[model samples]
Target: MEMQGEERIAARRDIVWAALNDPEILRQCIPGCQSLELKSPTELSASVKIKIGPVSASFSGDVVLSNINAPESYTISGEGKGGIAGFAKGGADVILTEDGDDTILAYEAKAEIGGKLAQLGSRLVGSSAKKLAQQFFADFNAAVSAQAAANS
Candidate 1:
């Protein structure tokens, strides 16, 4: 599946960029995230629990950041294993552009599922993925905006 969207965050570009790279911020923002540990500047290990339709699973994975252009854009990718449930892998290309005192964050993402997850039907899986993405961005925006307000 593929998805793309943009969000206008009420924060400076630099602040938004920093938050994007912060594992703590990501762990807090990502839906169902249990833990996120930075293994390197460009790598992270994460565990997330999610429910799709009637399936519930905990996924453990390593996220990698590549094609990086600091404070501008990067490609983030990861794959997770969920034991009997299945596996999920995806990547997103994120771009941040300055919009006055705020920042415009845009992303294009693509994902694939195998095993039982793929058996759930595309319509259901796609809707769930879209909802999850939206929730993540909304939470991320709120966290960044709050932090910016606190600092200023």
Candidate 2:
């Protein structure tokens, strides 16, 4: 599955970029994210609990950041295992740009799944993945917006 969207943030580009790279903000915005830890400046580990149709499982994943330009753009990729439920791996390319006093955040991502989740059906996996991605982005946008408003 692939997902793409844009968010208009009421903050400076540098602030938005910093928040994007902040482990705490990422953890708070990711849906079902139980925990997120930064392994290094360029790496992070996350644990998430996800439910799709009748399957639910906890997944632990590692993410690596590359193609990075501080306070601008980067590419992040990760994969996770969910025991009997299945497995998932994906990556996203994110860009942050300044628009006058605001920030524009855009992302394009692609993901794949296999095992029980895939065996059940691709449609279910795709739909659920899309929904989860949308929800996560919505939460992230709201989070940044709220923080910017508060600071302003």
Candidate 3:
């Protein structure tokens, strides 16, 4: 599956970049995220629970950020196991550009699933993924906006 989208954050590029890389902020933005640990500058371990269609599962995964361009763009990838439910792996290329007083965050993502998750059919899985992505960005935008407000 493939997905791409963008959001305008009411914050500067640097602030947005910093927030995006922060585990605390990510944990708040990620839907059903139980924990997020930053193992290194570019590595993270996480546990998240999700319900897609009729299947509900908790997934533990490792995320790695590549092609670091400090405050500009990077590629993030990870894979998760959902016990008997299935497994999922995905990667996203994210870019940030300054737009007036805001930052425009753009991303292109691709994902693949196996086992029971794959059996759920592409339409259902894809729809769930899209909703999840939307929810993440909405939360992210709100968090960044609030942070920016607090700093001002």
Candidate 4:
């Protein structure tokens, strides 16, 4: 599945960029995230538990940042294995554009799933994925804005 959207965060591009790279911020922003640990500057290990329709699973994966352009854009990709439930893999191209004191964050994302998840039907899986993505960005925007306010 594929999705794209943009959010106007009430913070500077640099602050937003830093928040994007911070594991603590990401851990809070990612829906269902149980834990997130930075393995390196460009890599992280994460565990997330999710429920789709009637299926629930815990996924452990490694997320990597690539095609990086500091404070501007990057591609974040990861794949997770959920035992028998299935596996999910995807990537997102994120771009940050400055607008006054705020930052415009845009992203184009694509995902693929196999096993029981794929058996759940495309409509169900697609809608759930969209909702999860929306939640993540909304949480991220709130976190960044709050952090910016606190710092200022």
Preferred candidate (TM-score higher): 1 or 3: 1
**What overall lDDT goes with each candidate model?**
0.97, 0.89, 0.95, 0.98
Q: What stretches of model 4 exceed 4 Å from their correct place? A: none
lDDT of 3 by residue, 1-152 (tens): 99999999999999999998999999999999999999999999999999999999999999999999998999999999999988999999999999998999999999999989889999999999999998999899999989998998
- What local lDDT does model 4 show for residue 38? 99
Expressed as tens digits, the lDDT of each residue in 33-129 for candidate 4 is 9999999999999999999999999999999999999999999999999999999999999999999999999999999999999999999999999
Better of 2 and 3 by TM-score: 3
Show the lowest summed lDDT stretch of 10 residues, model 2. Answer: 114-123
Pairs clashing within candidate 2: none
Residue 125 CA error for candidate 3 (Å)? 0.3
lDDT per residue as tens, model 1, 35-122: 9999999999999999999999999999999999999999999999999999999999999999899999999999999888889999
In angstroms, how far off is 130's CA in candidate 1?
0.2
For all predicted structures, in order, the TM-scores are: 0.99, 0.95, 0.98, 0.99
User: For this target, which candidate reaches the highest lDDT against the unseen true structure?
Assistant: 4
- Per-model tally of clashing residue pairs: 0, 0, 0, 0
lDDT score for candidate 4 against the true structure: 0.98
